[model samples]
Each structure stands twice: as structure tokens, then as C-alpha cells.
Target: MSETHDHSNEHDHATHTHDGKPIQEDPLPSLEAQILEASVRELLIEKGVISADDVRRAIDQVESRTPALGAKIVARAWDDSEFKALLMSDSDEALMAFGVDMRPTELCVVENTDEVHNMVVCTLCSCYPRPVLGVPPAWYKRRDYRSRAVREPRAVLQEFGTQIPDQKQVRVHDSNADLRYLVLPQRPAGTEGWDQEKLARLVTRDSMIGVSDALAASDIGG
Candidate 1:
């Protein structure tokens, strides 16, 4: 993908994994960066800029950010039409329900439908929707996926065992520092009369990434 982002053109899925399998974890930062972080943390504590407790709390907060949050958002969108419209329109306002603040950056929610499939990638870097989807899967941050997703999305999706029909258009969105995206996958069938909580079980990280569809209701014995 080019550095220039053109949202107008429809572009497509690199999976964090296939069929909800556990994806490889993202690698740690470079040793230099790690050392720098530690030094900065200690210096802050020494200078009374922040407490050790504060550091621990911040670590916990980052750890707590996960795909489950995004799943809840998707499930809510499926169950509540009004909220879904808000998400598709004013995403920041809709995200308020989850107590998420996307101030310096904006979250754009793209939906996958029968006619068009969608995917997210950061060609420039690993700019992801962290507050909503947590850390991106390791593959999403790799050079191969970053480059190939926009060029050969259908082939990439095939590698992930996702076969989009020829009739459906595949669209790829490039994420950046100031803008991020989350794929609002289509709700699966056979889920009538399901509550939000129960419906949430069908949502998965890969589906929200647009690499695959939500878990079939029968998959969970629903």
C-alpha cells in the first residue's frame, strides 16, 4: 500500500489466524527501546514525576485491552440498530458507550456485507486500533502482510482459508497514526432471539479484522 491513503477506492484479509485459532504473539520491542523504556520509568519515579504504582497500573491497563472489547462492540451493533448506525456514522460518539476515548486519533468502523468484504492494514507501520482491538496480531505488523494485503488481498485471504466469492468486492483500509479502523463483520445467520452476551460469543478477533466471518451459531451449540 502507498503512504497516501485513499479510502474511496475499494481494495481486502490478512488473518491474525484461521478459524479462531490462537495467533502468534507480537514480538517485544527492540532491546534498545526496552532499555530506554525502563530508564525513563525509573527516572520518572526518581523525579517524583510518577510512582511505581502508577507504572504498574498503566501496564495492567494495556494488558486489559483486548479483542473481547471489540467483540462486545460488534455484538451490540448486531443487536441494536440505533447503536450500529451511530458506530457507522459518529464512531467516537458511539464508542462512548464503552467508555473509550479516541481523541488524538479517529476510529473508522467499516462493515462487511454480502456485496463487499473489508480488511485493515498499516502499510507505513503497525498503526492499529489499540483501544478497541488491543494489540494487532503479529502477522499484521510484519512486512509481508503490510505489503501484500493491499496488493494481493484475495491471495492472502486464501492463505488464511478465507475464500471470498468473485461477486463480492474486497476493500482494504490503511491505518495510520491519526486514523484507525475496525471491521464490523456481518452477523451470522441462525442467531435469532439471541441476547447481546450470547451473540458476542460468535464474534472473534479475526472476524473483526475481516479475515473471516463470525462463528456460526452451531459452532457454539446455539
Candidate 2:
């Protein structure tokens, strides 16, 4: 196994282990739990802090797909050398190329490297590039991933079917602040003169999350 990150003292799974036998945990919460949850919602509604429409809108926003927009930006970066340079320097401009702008928050930075890989994890909470990746999956929100990734990124990547070489460096990003991150993975081999549409297929959600690299031709039968 290769070392995938820097140990310069920068900033910064598994299963339900029960008794000897396999003990199935409670699948559903008790009736009391549901009632309590409902009561909380009722109280919040009564206080007028949030309305049904607001809740529905929030749900709709998460369910909406904005992946294509980000895909277009990434595809452009794959092909255009000048744009890639601009992206490394100014991500907001790079993102604007795909019409995805991070206006209020300019702290977001896109880091790129050849040997070491980058991945973003908000272990404390579900911090994400909602405008680009839309909403995050449930697992990314868990405290386990957020706490462990910054410590043992290699192990986390393995679970995602991504294993870094012992020689390579792995940089696990802890998105503990308002600054968000997007990975600019290395272009996979055997993809010479490939078009944007073809290249977009290689960029999986895992690649964006930093757990896995972009797909190479061999992996996708190219």
C-alpha cells in the first residue's frame, strides 16, 4: 500500500459489532420515537420558524439533479489546458464556465496534484457543494466518515474500491468550514483525443468525493 497524503502536521466503517452471534439491530424506531419526532415538527411549525412549503422546497432542491452542470465544467477542464489552469487559480471562474457560481462564499478552493489525491469529507456534518454535486448521500453525513477520513484516508478509499499506492500521497480534506472542495482528478490513461461526452462518463460520484479516481478506459471497457 502506498502513502497517499502528506504528514506535515497540516490541519485535520465498518459494521455493527455485537455479541458472539449475529444480532440484528432494531430496523425501525419505537412508536414513541416517531411520536416524539412528530411532536418536534409540530412545535417547529407552530413557532412559524419553517413552513410546509419551505420543507417541500428544501426536499425538492436536494432531489433535483445538477450533476450535468458540473459535468460540463469538468469536461471542459479535461480538454482545455487554459481552462484547467484558470480553474487551479480561480475555481469560481472555472465553475462559472459551467454556469455554476459560488457567489457569497469565495473561500472554496480547488486543489490539483499528480501524485497525491484529494477528497472532501465533512465529518462533523453534511457539508457539500450543493450547487454542483447537488445533495450529499446519507453516508457522507455520518460522523464516522468525517472523523476517520482525515486520519485514515487510505482505508476509507479502499471501501470505495479505491486503493492508493504506498508511494503515492493521499490528501483527505476535512471540510470543517464554509470552504468546499472539488477534486480535479488526473486524466485516466488510454483516453487520447476523447470528447467531453465520452470523458464525462468516466467521472463518477466516487471520483468527485475523492474516494476513487476517475475511470480509466480499462475499467469502463473503453
Candidate 3:
């Protein structure tokens, strides 16, 4: 006889861990790109254009960014309509209220509604809002994703398991030069009266990138 199952229970059992360390079963061989980067960095240091301390500080800054910063802003927007309105109106100002240091970069917040679905891409390169959403995913930097996202967004999103309704219009925003786009996904159902911390848990990096929707209540054990 077939048995009823709680998929969440199975999910818990399938958790993969490495004892709080990264698992590097097979390290990648050095590539020409890596050599090029090293050469350029050393050249800059030798020329006194940038110091080794500058390089270390840059790496540390990049490592400090995480998706949690974006999630907090998303959760606050979900909780306050005024904040949402301000965010959509002026993302830089709205982000400043949350103590997000955008500095010298422009951010545009796009809202996902019942009638419109938004997706972000960098046609040229991975010019993302690193201060807010951390580093862009590896797939986000792929040529296939960048090209296909603008050409066939529906199909692209479908491959990511984000099927927009037939009636909804899919809008693709390309990040170029200085402007970067962030998707403000609609709050998931069955999460009414939830606090910002709890709501933040529903937000994911992909959702902010507009590749997927926010997690549902059941998906995160509401």
C-alpha cells in the first residue's frame, strides 16, 4: 500500500553538510583566466595603482555582502505599504533608510504583480547590486542566461521552474553601465501577520534576482 508522506520530513533527511567546512572533493585545475587576473593584479600593485591592502579590503568587502541584507529590505517592504511605495519610487533613498550603503551605484526596484512579472539580467556582464544582494550566481554570469533572458524570458524562467501565468506579462530588465534592477516579489500567501524576521526567511537570492518567486509558507515550515 502507498503511504502518505510529509515532503518536508524527507527534505530534512536529505540535508547535505560538510562539518561546517567546504567540501572540495576535486579541485579545479588552474585556468588561463586565473593567471591573467593574477598578472593584472600584480602589475597594478607594482605600478602603485593599487596596494595589496586595497586588494585585501576589496575581497573582504565582497565577502561581507550576503542575501540577508536584501531579504531584510524585502521583508520590510512587505510589511509596510508606504515603504514599498517609497522603494519603488526611489530605491536608493529607500535602501538608505535600511542602512544599505549603495554608494556610486544606481538601484531600481521592480515589483512583481499579478499582471506583470519582472526578471533582471546583465546582457554585457554581471553588473549586479553586490552591496544589497551579494555576488551574482554563477548561472547569472553565463552567456546562455544573459542572452536567453532577454530573447525568451518566459522559456528561461520556465527552465528555472518559474511559470508565469498566460495572462501575466513578463518584463526583462537589462543591467548596463550604472543601473541595476532588483525584483520585489509579492508576499507569499498564508504568511499573514508574520514578523519581518519570519518574512525574511521566505525571501531567497533567486527571488530577488527574479528567476523565482518567494518561498511559500509550507516550503519553509510556516
Candidate 4:
């Protein structure tokens, strides 16, 4: 009898394993990209194009911002009709009233209603309202989300556990360098007498991004 050989097994063993354990490939691209970015930043600083202090200050400013500020704005809007009107018309002014410094980038507030649902995305890049909502989430910066958001917003929202009825209009906003979007989620029912502070607790970061709805009355021990 001739000895039988399994070439496919040999090939798999060679490519996918070393000794008895599976070979793990080095995931260095992210580290390499970070190193390249640091190198470029150092070069720019050396060239006097931008100073180290400038970078530090910018980072500090970004770090100082948080989603709580956005929640306050949303809650105020939900409680006060006049503020909601102002927010929809001029978000910067409305935010300024709350002591939020949203300069340089114009904020466009999209209101979610019974008839219309809104979603925000940055197709070109992750341009977001950092002053109001802090840094964009990692998932938001992904190319897949940016592309899919505009292409199929309802489906994207569904994945985020937000189900919009077919009868309602789904509006997708693409944020750019000059303009960023913030979604004003509809006020939840059964909270008619809720104060701004209590209402703010119901406004989540994801709701402001339009990926989820405001916390229901039952969600926050209400």
C-alpha cells in the first residue's frame, strides 16, 4: 500500500501555526500609524508651523468638553418651548446661553418629531461638535458608519436599537468642516412635569447623535 499524504493539512500547518500553537500575526499598523503621526507632529513643531504648546492647549480644550453639556442643552430645550425654538434656529446662541463655547464650527440642531427622524454623520471626516458633545465615538469615526449612515439611515439606526416607523421620514445629515449636527430627540411621554435637571438625565450621548432615543420614563427609575 502506498503511503497517503495530506498536502492541505501541511499547507495549513505551515501558514496558520508554528509548532503546536496557532501563529498570531502582529497587529502593528495602528501602532505604526501612531508613530508616523507623532513623527509628523514633531516635524511640524520643529519647523515652527505649530508649537507644542498649541497642540497641548488644543488637546486640553477637547478634554475639558463632555456630553453633560449637551445633555443640559437638550433638557432645557425639552422643558422650554422658547429655548427649543432658539436652539433650532440658532444653536450657537442657545448653547452660549448655557456657557458652552461653540465657536469656529457652526452647530445645526435637527429636531426629531413624530413625522421626522434625524441622524448625523460625517462622510468626509469625523467633524463633530466637540465643544458640546466632546470627542466623537470610535464607531462614529469608522468609514463603514459614515458611508452606511447616508445610504441607509433607518437600517443604521435599527442596528443601534432605534426603530423608526416606515411612515415617518428619515433624514440624514452630513457634517462637514464648517457645520456639525446635533439631534434634538423628542421628549419622552409621561414626563410632562419633569424639571430640566431630571430631564437632562434622560438625554444620552447616543440620542444627541441620533443613533438612539431619549431614555424612556421607565429607564431611569421614573
Candidate 5:
């Protein structure tokens, strides 16, 4: 279930629409946070720090980046070994090809192996890789998940309908402000000779989040 090790900095999705638009689950800001944000925006506008048009453009850009972007990265990794090596080692450099900059924080890519299954959680707060994954789910930001994920991760996975094999070791990674984790899910079998586009379709936001495996060939009627 859980292991005792000095994994202080060990780390690091689930459901989502397959289209370019990723569903934001209860993404509304709290009243207090909203008020504070509005006040800050007004102050910035009043001081000429930023114009209203700038805000609109920024929002558009953020919304434009979706899980599809993450899917493309995962697909390339599955198809090309060279790209996978670069993604695992130099994520920032690899992500630059997608114009994603993990500024003020670095991305730690974790791979799910035959013996180990990886899951990511932010114990203190939700520090996710928004540049690629878009917004975090509402359940992710809840107190229940933050506490239970480290304490009873297997149970949590089961709740998400993911049942791991008994022989596999479940390792929970905790994400912090400076570092964010992304799970590079193991590609399914029977996908040999598949192109990147076909492979990308198998990659889901949930798989990259480590809550589930990538869509199998059978799932896609392949």
C-alpha cells in the first residue's frame, strides 16, 4: 500500500473529455479568493499594470492548453524511444517543442513499470502542471484526497475503479510548489505498428494522472 522511505521529494488526472476541451470540474474559485482576485485585477487595471484586453488574451491562452497537448506528448513517447528518453530526462527541453515552459517549477516525469505503479498527490496544496494538464479536478483539491492518498492510496485507486495487481508495488508521490509530477503510463499491448495519432487516442487525461491505464486495443475496437 504505502512504503516508508526518505521520499521527501519523490514527486509529483482522471476523467476528462477526449476532445480538445477538457471539462473543468467545479473549477469555480471560492468567494474569498474571487473577491481577492477581482480586487487585484481592478488595482492592476487602475495602475496600468495590465489592461482588460490583456486579461482576456491570457485567459484564452490558458484555456487553449488542454489535455490533448499532454496526450500528444505521451503518444510521441510511446512511439519514439529517443523522444521518450529525452522526455524522461530533460522534460523542459522536450516540452519546449510543445511551447510549454514549467517556469518557477520543474516537471518530474514518473514512469509506471511492471513492478511499480505511480500516483501523484499534493499533500499541502494542489501544485499541478497546469501548462500541460490544464486545470486540476475538484476532487483533487479536496481535503479527503490529499490526506487519504498518502494514507490509503490503494483504497483510493479502488474507488476510482482502478484495481492493481497484488504483485505490483504502489508508490505514492507527493508534489510540492517547486516540483510537479506527471505519470507516464505504461502503453497497452497489441499497439505495435501503431502511429502516433492512433496511439495518442489511447492516452487519456486520467491515464497521465495515474488513476487508470491507457486505453487498450480492445477498448478502442482495435
Candidate 6:
């Protein structure tokens, strides 16, 4: 996932712990890159450029929230077929049911199919349904993913250990400025008796990304 870090003060970097690992290496940048970056930073600092705290606060705001809007949309789709149909026909109104209101009703949502699964990727920048899914994943923003996914989505999905059956269809959604997309993964079998809460637990983030399908009761934990 994309992460925002605090850089309010130079010393702030010293306060973090990564998996209980000691902060031995800074792993920031090469000497050349560092000098260049520092010069630009110093210039900005000298010019009374935006404070490090402001930058840190913005990053915090981006990372602190969950994709509740996206989750709500998905959950409601799972619960109501009529709404799901509406989501297909009119995504804006459908999103409103779950408290997601996108201004342009032109937005589209593609449901993952048994033969054709759908995934969202932005080849340029991290264009996303922020009102719903929040920020995109770090990997999603990587050049490799952005460049190759549109060209070879199946290959990238395979790299992520997601296999698309040979006979199944794959639809790659290229998210640009005007269009926004979301994946509605196929609900799993053996969930006939499952309720919405139980079903939500089965909705893995990967499933929403169309890399995997929702889990059945067997996949749930206590």
C-alpha cells in the first residue's frame, strides 16, 4: 500500500522501527542524489518553503484512512442484487446507497467474471477512485506495473500469483482522467448460508483488485 511518512524534522526519521529491526542504515539515496536533494530542500527551507510538518501532515492524512467508501460499495453490492444492477447501470446512484458520491455519473464499474475478470490500473499517474478506494497501492503506482499491466495484465497478475484460467476472459481497465473503475469480484460458492458480515470477512483486498475471488466460509478465520 502507498504510505505517507513524517519528515517534519530531520530527527523524525530516527524515531521509526521497522519490524523490530534496528535503524542501522538510512537507505535514503546515493551521495550524489542526496546532495542534490539536500540542496533543493535547503533552498526550499531557506525560502520559507512549506514546512516539513505540513508535508508530514498531508502524508498522514493520505495514509491514516481506510478505503471505507470502496468497502461500503462492495458490501452493498454483495447484499443487494438490485443495487448491484443499479451499480452496473448507474454507478453514481449505486455508490450513494453506500455513501459514496462521485460527481460525474459517467464513472463505470466492471464486475469480475468467471471468464473475464477486471482490474484497474493507471499507466500514467496514480489516478484512482479516491472518494471510494482511497490511494492506490505502492506497487500499483510502480512504472513496471503501470507500463506492463496494460500491455500484459495476465503476465503481471501471474507475477502476483494470480492465475487466470486459460479459458477465462480478462478485461483490463485503463483508468484515465475522465473514467474511474472498481472490480466486483465474483461471490464464491458454498456461501449460500453466509450473511453479509460473514461475507465481508471473505472479501480480501486482492479480490477487490480482481487478482483473487472472494473467499468461501472455509476461508474465514475465527
Most accurate candidate by TM-score? 5
Q: What is candidate 6's local distance difference test score?
A: 0.68
Model 6: worst 10 consecutive residues (lDDT sum): 14-23
Q: Runs in model 6 with CA error above 4 Å?
A: 1-61, 104-106
Put down candidate 2 lDDT per residue, 1-222, tens digits, no spaces. Answer: 103333235322112222222212222324555677789888888999888788889889767855555556677788988887887788887776566767665525444466778888875556787777777776776556766777778888888888788878787786767677777677788998999888888877667778777778887779
Which lDDT tens digits does candidate 3 get at residues 1-222? Answer: 012234334322112222222211222333644777899999999999999999999999898899999999999999999998988898878888877867787888999999999999887657898989988898887667777888889989999999899999999998867777889999999999999999999999999999999999999898
TM-scores of all predicted structures:
0.83, 0.73, 0.80, 0.78, 0.83, 0.69
Better of 1 and 4 by TM-score: 1
Poorest stretch of ten by lDDT in candidate 3: 17-26
Off by over 4 Å in 4: 1-36, 43-54
| lDDT tens per residue, model 5, 1-222 | 012223235321122112222222322234555677899999999999999999999999887777888899999999999999999999999999988999889988899999999998886668788888998887787756776788888998999989999899999988956888889999899999999999989998888888888899888888
Candidate 5 at 177: error in angstroms? 3.1
Off by over 4 Å in 3: 1-36, 43-50
Better of 5 and 6 by TM-score: 5
Worst 10 residues of 2 by lDDT: 12-21
What overall lDDT goes with each candidate model? 0.83, 0.69, 0.82, 0.81, 0.81, 0.68
Backbone clashes counted, model 5: 2
- Pick by lDDT: 3 or 6, better one: 3
State residue 136's C-alpha deviation in candidate 3, in Å.
Answer: 0.4
Indicate whether candidate 3 or candidate 4 has the larger lDDT. Answer: 3
lDDT tens digits, residue span 103-151, model 1:
7999999999999999888876688888998878988888677778888
Between candidates 5 and 6, which one is better according to lDDT? 5
Choose 1 or 6, whichever is better by TM-score: 1
Q: For model 3, which pairs clash?
A: none
Worst 10 residues of 1 by lDDT: 12-21
